[model samples]
Target: MAHLGESIDVDNIVPERGDFEALPAGPYMVQITDSDVAETKAGTGLILKLTMEVMDGPFANRKLWTNLNFRNPNATAQRIAQEQIKQICDAVGFQGQLTDSEVLHFRPMRVQLVVKRDEQYGDRNEVKKYSALNGSAPPANKPQPQPAAQKPASSAAQRPASGGQTRPWGNRAA
Candidate 1:
């Protein structure tokens, strides 16, 4: 069990809610702070849930989230997720197999966020793209051209690597 350390004084405390509104759609510098794997709704696949925190600007420290469908029954969905992960890896300069997700954390990357609206769920922010802060990353909307095949870089960063109260609202494919 968990304790609050002190007794509560509910009546004396001000009841103000922190802003739950989503941040405006734009590229924000952020880093993955946490990640975990969970079974998908249908139990047919798994999802890699990522928790990211904004690293700069007025909204510094604000959190954003995304889920990559690591495995899914739908081929399109899985492909999309793989592509998304590749984008992130490329941004962080990781060019080989990603056995662990922890290696992606703590590296500041610029992510293009979009405000998504749904009639049933109001508005939420979706991580549309990831790029390195060095500006070498391709535009999020454009497809990155393929280069000649090459061996994985040997010096790639190798690092060993949420429970969720609610399902994340972003990354829904039509």
Candidate 2:
């Protein structure tokens, strides 16, 4: 056992636990915050684990996770994983070769998520698809035209600054 160096004040702290409920099924804008390459359960394959965070809306900052079996013992699983990787690259407009997963990090993209319930592991969100945040890739190092003096119609009218830069929440601050 370990002893505390100082006295504690439990009464002043909030007692509520964090909500673990699965997010409702739908498309969400997110960015890959982290990625890792690890061995599969059987120890015969490798998987790319990606951790993403919602960028906007009420669920902003919520985390979502997915694993791609890039080097699996099963041929079908490996093929599917490879295809998913390709789709992610295409969505982010990553051309040429991709040797590191970190290249995909911090790029905002849209993901279709569905809730899957398991008796043993509880419910979790599964990534169905990956796409560019907008219909097309964001401008890469190109200058954005300044809006006219007139007020913009809505939030949708706002655009990120040049160099494909965007705030962590996937929007430019007012």
Candidate 3:
């Protein structure tokens, strides 16, 4: 162990509460920060685990996880995963075959968050939907403009200045 020059007070350090609280579910500007293919909990199939970070809004810097089971023994699960993957690809304007590296690349996109309730685990955030930033359907053949590598701005800066309203919980009207 290295010697300290001065005595430090451990009690003076304040723990950050945000790290423990669940982010209120709602639409957020997010980016894919990390991803990997891993075996399912049951050890029966593979899943693509995505770690997404909220780039803006009230819950900026918070993380939300999403798993896509593209290689499952169950046909329905595979189909649903494929569909969701297609939707994500379209939203991000990615063309051609999907690869693990490409999917892991950092890309900003809009995601709708929803609360999923479990009897044992309580409530958790889930991705409800995805959309292009321009509020229009992604072109079938054309690729959307990609932003350069840089720090993402807050949702207030990215979204329209006027209609900046956000509903954290669910779609229950404010």
Candidate 4:
């Protein structure tokens, strides 16, 4: 969540209001977040690059940040990223953060955030907007990536090579 600073300098402050048409309209799941970039991509069949910055929050001069996840590996992630970025920037309280890199990274601050779809949009009955009374993690978008598989351990032991078999099973300790 982004917020105003305790001693904000609105004189030097200017809210971000840029135009982008690279993405389509749909839902986006923010994964990781930072100040430099918004690594967002298509989800719910949309394509776009969503970026943002400073917005009024609990404190002042603060902004909310989030990295988008399409939750659809089959779809073009970048396209969805572009579209999502467009929607997010246009959405209320989404004071677009400017960054050269596509990845999201940023400073800490309060925010009027709407990263989660249900919390922002209520078209879907299953998903719900935020409950300000209860500050908690938003609904999850995708499943976690599974870990890699491992090989099994051997059960047999090594045998002696000097000239004879110490035992039928294996070697006998000297």
lDDT of 2 by residue, 82-150 (tens): 989887876775654566888789888899999999889788889888888786774342334555775
lDDT of each: 0.77, 0.79, 0.70, 0.32
TM-score of each: 0.71, 0.72, 0.67, 0.22
Q: What is the Å distance of residue 138 in model 4 from its true position?
A: 32
Ranking by TM-score: 2, 1, 3, 4
Per-residue lDDT of model 1, residues 1-174, tens digit only: 889999899989986544556899999999999999999988999999999999999989998889999799999999999999988877866654576788778878899999998778678899888888986754332334434464334423221111222112221111
The whole-model C-alpha lDDT of candidate 4 against the native structure comes to 0.32
CA displacement after TM-score superposition, residue 89 of candidate 2 (Å): 1.0
Clash pairs, candidate 1, are none
List the candidates ranked by lDDT, beginning with the highest: 2, 1, 3, 4
Please, what are the lDDT tens digits per residue for candidate 4 over residues 93-134? 123232333322232222233323354433221111212112
Q: Which stretches of candidate 2 lie over 4 Å from their true place?
A: 7-19, 138-174
- Decide which is better by lDDT, 1 or 3: 1
- Please say which candidate is ahead in TM-score: 2 or 4: 2
Shift of residue 27 alpha carbon in model 2, Å:
0.6
Give candidate 4 regions above 4 Å deviation. Answer: 1-54, 69-73, 76-79, 88-174
TM-score of 3: 0.67
In model 2, what is the error at residue 131, expressed in angstroms?
0.7
Model 3 steric clash total: 0
